[model samples]
Target: MTKLALSDEILMKIDKPARYIGNELNSVVKEKDTVDIRFVMCFPDVYEIGMSHLGIQILYDMLNKREDVWCERVYSPWPDLHAILKEENIPLFSLESQQPVKDADFLGITIQYEMCYTNILQILDLSQIPIEAADRTENDPILIGGGPCTYNPEPIAEFFDLFYMGEGEISYDALLDLYKKMKQEGASRKDFLHEAAKIPGIYVPSLYEVSYKEDGTIAGFEPVYEDVPRTVTKQIVTDMTQAVYPEKPIVPFIKATQDRVVLEIQRGCIRGCRFCQAGMVYRPTREKDVERLKNLRTRC
Candidate 1:
């Protein structure tokens, strides 16, 4: 029998019970026993907002493409559900498998904005996972933070075991494969994180140490180990044409912020506003080929 953390009574009380239940059209369903790695991609907000983000959808499609991996979706429950879960002592669960996040191999949270910091803590608390990375045991999920906010991840660095510095498409496969091999060898959490830092675009917070100046500014950021790289580089796809894009995005049961197919005509705005963070990080503005766009438009 399948186990669900949210009961019928609780679902009935929530405004949109669809947010908790999985199996909407286009969602990936796989036998949990068959996969070596289970990754839960989380967004620190309500379902509608998280569903609108394109980054999670792309990663979901990319990870599920691997036969050995099953990627699931999770969003911060609404206040009503949150209260009930806390009151009833129910652990927060993934929308797909309805399993607690601690069971997953990795718990990846996308930090798009600073305001979502509190919500991230809420996710950890509600899921029965440690809120701080330092407190986590070997059995705990590897807490990872990614997305635009990763550009300046210092503020919430203590909460995440590691941060993916740039685009997920480039380095996630290598990271996941390394994790599977390491887990097979019965590697300790510390050992796994140390090895993971070797991968480009992956920044292991524990591997480095930070010192502050008297004025409350960052005085020094140094790696604890001599072997670890002093700086992590951002991963980028050289050719957008060759990049894998999500063809079938998961459709939600209730209305989402964006209820239609969204085409990424281009990445990195050409305007290059001096103060724009996205423009700077995703610079050199690349656009999809007209032929490819036309084909995609016709197919959808």
Candidate 2:
């Protein structure tokens, strides 16, 4: 049997042991040695809240489709479990193998809300990884921030190495391929980031220098390297049918916040609302085809 990061005693004491013990139906597991890249998708909140997110699931499915890659899930442990982990000095681990998140090649944390910023720090601390990007070494997993809050990531910009702006379905494959190539060639972290910045929609915070006026107003953002672009554009999927959809979502042993089959019928609301950012950010609403959606339903 595999040794779990969380002991039996800890599991028994926790409210939901299922949150730590993965192996749910449809959860992909591969031999670590066979995988070229290990990516951990994190939600800086409890498992219930993270599991309910449809965006994470979509990315999870898309990433796992590559034979060379293995994607796992992790979430912020509840306070009761958090205390035990800290007290025992155990590193933060993924649900699938109970392996340390720091060991993964990429630690992608979805930032849905601004409130979870502190929780992101908590995750980094638990993982035994540096909280700030500058403090991290090549041994550390490249910290990536994504989701809605990335529209304006300057507030928590120092913490992350890169931010994936707009929809994830666009640039992840290119990003992962680049990482794999660079890792094989023994490329330095700086070298990788410089190249990664070239990919459309990938924002490498380190490559850009931000300035502020005395009045705390914006001055201008300039690129540190000549090769790096001054502005990073947002990526979006033009056709919904071409995009990959999760056939089966991982089922939790315990009741999740929303433990039901989720179908993303449409993206980018048609209503041009001035107040809401959702309609503005996710523009030119695209939807999945009726027959394709119907076919997807049968697979589940």
Candidate 3:
């Protein structure tokens, strides 16, 4: 499969011209031939902060390894970029394919915490996609979320069609494969989600009806559809050393929070702060495989 030649014109149109150019030494690139799924991996935060996330980079690399899958990036618009989007009426797009978020088969978001709530809305608004799962149609990308915030995936449940709890290494493929198959059969978005809810780690808010007691405590969450779990179990990957990354990283011209090239050192911290969801959800913190860093060291 031939690589899509990222044009200079597209980069020029963007506010941070460097973000679009992918020339980093560690970034991953897969052949375009015989691919099955295309994913637009989005972060609700600005490019600067999101670039500091090593998990996103790892997942992006691993997911792109398959010949059938292509994964790119979309981020919340900066204030200036948001203004440009508002004035130009331009939609949110991916850094790799430069395709609008609407066109992607799966729209995956990394939710590290609660602060990105409004930013999620802003991202969808900028992407020109619906904010609520109920509002979107079958044509829209199946909205998915992951990261620490998924443990209490109640408040934002209305927005995301599916939540990928814990690490998404395998679940990502399962979700996309389900979508690719269901889509081939002309299944509606609702039907796909109802079935997708059956997959472990995928919490589809729309399928499970939530009722609260008079006191506002969650009375019970029940699935309208059959086979949906009463409690959606979080996905966990035992190994981290085998993680994948882009062979040529996307080097942003605009300086990010981590000015130097970045990499993930760990997953799921054990701070044990009762207030923190990730602290509890991602139990049993794990460190990166020391051997993997041999490559990361070369780039740093």
Candidate 4:
């Protein structure tokens, strides 16, 4: 059982209590429900920024809608908070329920961008978990990842068990279902990943061997398993206009980027930049209803 969470007096001394005490009008709570699968929706950055992400909110909302799945958010603690936790010997816990992250069944990290590489290691380390997948034991939660960064997952490839290449709304659903089946069979992490790799839009790096040339360019990468694909395409949600927008975004008591609360005005982009794969792959565009957006602004 968890001890009393950081008390209000302490929260006052620290930053942003709105972020930690989640009475947000739109926040969803399902951890207490009996669910076979638990997902730790992680953002590899400090809490202030991660709590502000619309993508993270969208996916978290979608996943928790499933009766069999419970979703919890995790973000890398700020440097000062990191020092505080280390001194107190406290593991990273979800802001909503104040439970340790290690209790989850699946650790789904969102590699939003490449720059957060070191932060990803920081997150796992803060959670009292191993940074490398190879070192983790069976008791460790399965470390799944995806996001724009997964398009070129090679940079932080060593950490994630599998990368969801495409749009997560569909891809992660398949992954969770597949994992439930594998869990029933009592498959090992290696073998479970072997099968998860077979799913479209899922990239299991362990099944593909990477070799680098002297010049530092990738010399070759060959899939050891016939089921694995050479390149995984990032998934894009086709229709986001009708998507559930979180109006009562979790407001942090402390200041943060867009701390006032904002709505996802749109999704994807129409002007596809050639160099922008997120644009190229995530074709088409969807905009939130203007009336709804105005409502969001009013509420905030």
- Please list the C-alpha lDDT of all candidates, in the order they appear: 0.90, 0.91, 0.76, 0.75
User: What tens-digit string does per-residue lDDT give for candidate 2 at 187-285?
Assistant: 999899989999999998889989989987669899998988888899989999878889888877778899899877888998889998778888879
* Clashing pairs counted in every model: 0, 0, 12, 9
lDDT tens string, model 3, 176-256? 788889878988888888888888888888777899999888988898866788888878877767665544555665677
Better of 2 and 3 by TM-score: 2
Candidate 1 residue-wise lDDT, 90-119, digit = tens? 899998898898899999999988899999
1-300: candidate 4 lDDT, tens digit per residue: 334356656666666555555545566676455788888888888767887777788788778778988887887776767887788888878765677777778888888777888888888887888888888888788887777777778877888877888667767778889888888899887888888887788887778999998987788988997767776655666666565555545555556665655566776678888888667655567777788777778865
- The TM-score of predicted model 3 comes to 0.85
Pick the winner on TM-score between candidates 1 and 4. Answer: 1
Tell how far residue 295 is off in model 2, in angstroms: 1.2
Superposition-based RMSD of candidate 2 using all C-alpha atoms, in angstroms: 1.2
Model 2 TM-score relative to the real fold: 0.97
Off by over 4 Å in 4: 1-4, 7-13, 31-33, 241-256, 259-266, 273-281, 284-300
Estimate the overall C-alpha local distance difference test score of candidate 4: 0.75
lDDT at position 133, candidate 3: 86
